[model samples]
Target: MNRQTKGVLLAAGGASLWGGSGAAAQYLFSTTDISTTWLVAVRLITAGILLTAISLAHAPQQVRALTHQRRNVGYLLAFAVLGMMNSQLSYFLAVKYSNAPTATVIQYLQPVIIIVWLAFAQRQWPRRIDCISIVIALIGTFYLVTGGRLNTLTLTPVALFWGLWCAVAAALYTLLPQSLLKRYDALAVCGLAMLVSGILLIPSLFTIPWPHLSSGDWWLVIYIIVGGTMLSYTMFLQSIRYISPSVTGILSAFEPLVATLLAVTLLGTRMTVAGVVGSLMILLTTFLQAIPMQKILNLLGLKHHY
Candidate 1:
């Protein structure tokens, strides 16, 4: 296979593994009394340790140099607390309250949220495609949540709330680490963020009861920590070497699709016709947003991308 094809496959595989992990997590939640707090804490800490060790071994000076800058330290802390911990913790809670597919699809709202934020924060009106994307997202979200009904929801209220919060956290994760990522190795930044997030959540662990895991449960959790968080991330990052990031973003939509299929097959989760249509719409928005509008516009002999 060509290099680009290989990268696309790798990226798709990584996203599929991540989606599978969510289904596995849901299975564990159904079978075990695993607490969200406990799971998030352990996943971050264990993955953080292993990743940090690997990154440190690979680039000792670079990793250590990041710690010396006070501004970098501040960024790391913010990334840990808001991006790493917040997203993962909220996502787990969302999964606990709803199915894996529901949580995964809801978090797809992050892209739309980012667009809206950029519009307000940058003090600019959204362009034509942006406005269309927003409307498409809302229509999809409406169907996903209400199942084409008014004044009621298919998902529980608490699930909806946490899922939206999960989207916000996901957006923060996407945006907040750009500067750090530009300067530091990806592994260095991510490992430290996870490490610090896990450490900061330590005190809260005292308030929550410890969880007991069976052999099977431990296996599932390991899939989440290693396969989902670490290896998947590694593969996805590597994919960017061969393909444009916009392409990678488009391929990563496979995540929710995989999650939904796994939910239906393993977990016996059902979706209404409206739900399926809504998901397609949201998936379309992912494709729309992933388009390099300027490049496309140039190809079309148009000066304006909007």
Candidate 2:
């Protein structure tokens, strides 16, 4: 297969791993009494250790570079706090307050947030296709928030607020790494971010209880750290090496679809026809945004530029 094909597969695999994390986390929450803060702390610590070890093994030179770039280190620190810690914690809390499917759908808005951020940075309006996709995604999100019950679906204010925060955090996380990746290697970025996030969570370890967790809980934690945090990120970085970041971002929308399916199968969550339609619309919009119609036009020899 071509490099781009490998990249797309890696990205899709990463999305699948990420999708599985929601189910794992939901299962952990159901089985354990761990606080959100504590669970996040443990997750960061474990994921940090595993990722740091991987970086050291394969990219020791990148680790050395991190020591000299204090400014980059600071940026990574912020990235860990907001992107890793805050985003994860807020997402878990959203799942707790609302259902897994709702939280997952809300979290999928990150792409739209990134588009808005890019527009603001470039000081230009979004492309026509982007606008259309955004509209479709918003409609789907609205249906999801209402649980497909137009008249009776009311959201808890806290759930809505935290879900929005998750999207904002995800966008910030996505945008912050661009500058870093432009300057440093991917291993350095991932290592520093993981290290900093682990350190930031250290204080919470003491305040939150760290009692004995069950065997299943331990497995869930391991899955979160190894599969969700470390391997998934590794795949993401590797995929970005061969694919455009925009394409990778679009592929990430599949995470919600996977999560929603898992919620239905594992958590026994049900959805209405409107909800299903809305989800499809959002997914279609994400696809359109990723592979713009103009690109298709160019591919077909109908246009010179996209």
TM-score of each: 0.96, 0.88
| Candidate 2 lDDT over residue span 89-196, tens digit each | 888888777666667777767778888888999999987666776888888877766756767554688988988888888778777777777877776676667667
| lDDT of residue 182 for candidate 1 | 91
User: Any residue pairs clashing in model 2, and if so which?
Assistant: none
Off by over 4 Å in 2: 1-9, 148-151, 241-250, 301-306
Candidate 1 has an lDDT of 0.89
The candidate maximizing lDDT is 1
Worst 10 residues of 2 by lDDT: 146-155
Q: CA lDDT of 116 in candidate 2? A: 82
Give me the displacement of residue 276 in model 2, in angstroms.
Answer: 2.4
